[model samples]
Target chain A: MTATSFHFGEGDRTLYGVYHAPSVRRRRPLAVLLLNPFGEEAIRSYRVQKIIAERLAALGAAVLRFDYYGAGDSAGECVETSIDGMQTDILTAHEELIDLSNIRRVAWCGLGLAVPVALSAFSSANVNLAKFLGWDPVISGSEYIDDLTASHAKYLADALDMPERRIRRELSMQLTEVMGFGVSESLISDVVDLELNGSDLDVCDDVALIGRKSSGAFRKLHGQLTSTASSVSIEFDESVTWNSHQALNSIIVPNDSIAAIVRALADGDE
Target chain B: MNERIVQFGDDGRLSGVWNTQRKNSNRPTILLTNAGIIHRIGAHRLNVKLARRLADIGFDSLRFDLSGLGESAPAAGALGYERQSAQDISAAADFLEENGRSDSVIGIGMCSGADNFQRAALADHRLSGLVLLDPHAFPALGAAIENMINRYLDPYRWARKFSELKLNAKTLSLRTVRSKSEFSEYGGDTDEQGRLRPPKAEFGNELRTLTKRGVEIGIFYTAYVQREITRATQFFQTFSDYQLEGKVTVNVNPRVTHTYTTLQSQNMLLTEIETWLKQRFTD
Candidate 1:
């Protein structure tokens, strides 16, 4: 599987992406647009997304994995990033992939909070979409932010909280930087607004939300999606835990998760 | 200053983001690679911070994936991981030279990344300097014995250590050994006691050779390695007949970890690196 790294979008704020092209002999009907988790989780999930792209490419379809604007290798600063700006990046990446390959049919595989990003990207766009695959989909933006806060707390607990935090002035912040990514005041407001909309993944028919059974939130989300949308649970032999402060530096495959992604992408093979 | 994604090397399989400033004199370039499998962001976006900060100071930097790591495709050659990584580094440097990006380059890596860069710097004449962070650990008997004795005397420290280990053990039990990078993190449950000594004889030889060649070298050792080797003197002592005082800059910081996890730690590392580059590589 061959992958090419390129920048897309118009002048100013060009985004970085790794596009895995189809095999030599033949190509499938679908190409995947892999959206990443927000903040540091995107960095943690970089390897995972690349592997998924390669596997999909190996199976005869092309896949494009991109960094949201103002994040990763993408242009712009973290503080300048907004939910709307990132959604525009997703739409831009979607169009660029289609133009690059001249293949109309596209699928999505969003991880964690990025599931919402995928939904919002194709929400209004009239694109040839086949499958909607979300792994450990964050039910709502507020819930995800809450979990992020909890993760931040856990990180502090796990780490030797630096004594340097004792600054002269109060730690009054207009925004809190999650992990290493700076979450701007506008972005926080945007996320809260997203949460208020609920976990309605308004999209085309095919939907598969895979979540580790161990997570109570995931179990609830699975039930909600199955009842509300054309969603099904993609199960693995063993449950996976993708959210841990320890995962920041490590590269993990989550075999079951990959297998689930393969099954989801292979659905529209015809 | 401009930052853009660059597809460098032969056949364009290698990928990197170039952060450059319009230059007249050739400033020393910072060559950054993934720390093990951690990717070009370094531990806690240290490389990104370093690159952008370097750009502010008019120094160019290209942080890229080494062959199969991160976004770069895997190398097809029969070369091992280390050699492939070294070749990737050389390819990046060649790109810089060809494009008139910079005439001088300084390689930076930590842990195994440092090992590969050091191996390449010893061989590659294009490398003007290196910033080795927690490069390698060897048994420094004096430091090891001193730490053990300190632990023996400080019962409260021992208790805290025991408690930390217990909590860590719980997390360790859940994690499966998946990748070679992850495997190296554990060190294979081997007895690491008295392991920090004189670094391999070759490391010292390379240091002496690089210093003689007028290559500015700045090495940072975290408390993790410092506890074992103790002080900067042990490094010179490791390689006898090599008086590196003023010849090389060796910082033994007992506050930082191998991977700077905290914001303060990351800031301190960046500041030290910038200071070193300003003093050592300035024309």
Candidate 2:
């Protein structure tokens, strides 16, 4: 596999990405645009996405893994990048991949916050997405924020030798102060408000939802998806851990889960 | 709720239940690991609660008995806690995969059960994640005993006794054997005049080995749990550099005890699991 660097202008800002394609030219059925999680999760899940791209290529698929305006080797600061900018980055990447690979159809895979962001953006932008694979999409920004607050509180309590209750109160205040427009809140709230219960997202012929077994939230989200989407393929792999500490650090891929995704994508084409 | 006799290890088969529920979509398969010495029936209510809650959210979960505990086949040896339980976890995952119910697998274990899951997870990449409730560090047994003694014994007096003994003997070695005569000399197990005893083994080395492996770890602790939260924290911090870039999380449920008796505490754990799964497995 060989990688090439490229930049595109969305509005006044620039988005960067590293494109990976097979050296030998072969007819490819679909091109994939990769969307990643935000903050620390993005950093942790980078290697996994790289592996996924390589595997997809080996399966006769072309993939482009790129960063939003403020992420990775991309230009701009994280604080400057909003949900809208991230969506614009996805759209730009999708267009560039089509032009570069000469492929008409595209598949999207979004992890964590990116899933909801991508879903919300896809609906609004009217992008012709052939299929979407959400690893574990957050349905509620408020719940996610609460989790973050709880996690931060625990971390602070351990570090500062303060009571967890005190830490929780302070963290809540800090998070409340940080909420604003052009922030992640809009993206988060949009996901939370999304009516995931039916087939609305089954806009494409093939849609796959993957999640860790221990996550109740993803299961809930999946329930909503199953209720709405017809011909939507959902597979739960007990081997995959999403929100846990081990997933961030390990190279393990939950082979069964990946295989199921490959099967679903392949079956969709048939 | 369904019961089936499943074979474990080479020649052991035990009766176990398979609880199934239909949700909105196909949710991931969860294998619940029970605590040591706890039978499947003993854990049945709690497991049912957890499974029902997960199903309500869109997941399908199964809680099973480890071999030699509950209804499963008896352990072949005394070290049943580790080997048999690990095998049971592997078997459970295989069962789900074979039944076409799981595309990914997650293991949630309590106490020694958690340790077994950790070992099984290391051996099987099919397991995507692990949730450990009140995991005990091998060294914690000794530490707990020491702490209990320290709470009752006068430290200054013990120190003085040690110093005097060292001065009297050229080389002082306080090794107390548990022979019958020695027990009598120390006034028996319930002693009126007995010396403090040292632990059989130091657990730090074993713990270090476990942390060195690239496995995702989440631990829930209570006041009575063998290992202190500080030890788990230190393990993660010291080995953060060696950890698989993003796959380690250590959490403590302050509202819950080792057993997770309260609904609120259980909810906290469920919430953490949900959030973590969304982040790890979702797009």
TM-score of chain B of each: 0.84, 0.63
lDDT of 2 by residue, B189-209 (tens): 311112222221222233333
The candidate that wins on DockQ is 1
Model 1 over residues B181-269: C-alpha lDDT tens digits? 34455443211322222336656777888888888788888765755576777766665666566788778876555677546677788
Lowest summed lDDT across 10 adjacent residues in model 1 chain B is found at B189-198
DockQ of each: 0.27, 0.01
The candidate 2 chain A region of ten consecutive residues with least summed lDDT is A174-183
What is the alpha-carbon lDDT of model 1 when measured against the actual structure?
0.73
Identify the runs in model 2 with alpha carbons over 4 angstroms from their true place: A23-26, A158-162, A176-195, A227-230, A237-242, A266-270, B1-283
TM-score (0 to 1) for chain B of model 1: 0.84
In angstroms, give how far residue B30 of model 2 lies from its true place.
Answer: 48
* Tens-digit lDDT track of model 1 for A138-218: 766776776676565445433432322322012234335666666788888888666412255547677787777776767
lDDT: worst 10-residue window of model 1 chain A: A161-170
For candidate 1, give the lDDT of residue A70: 71
Model 1, residue pairs in steric clash: B138-B195, B138-B196, B138-B197, B139-B195, B139-B196, B139-B197, B140-B196, B140-B197
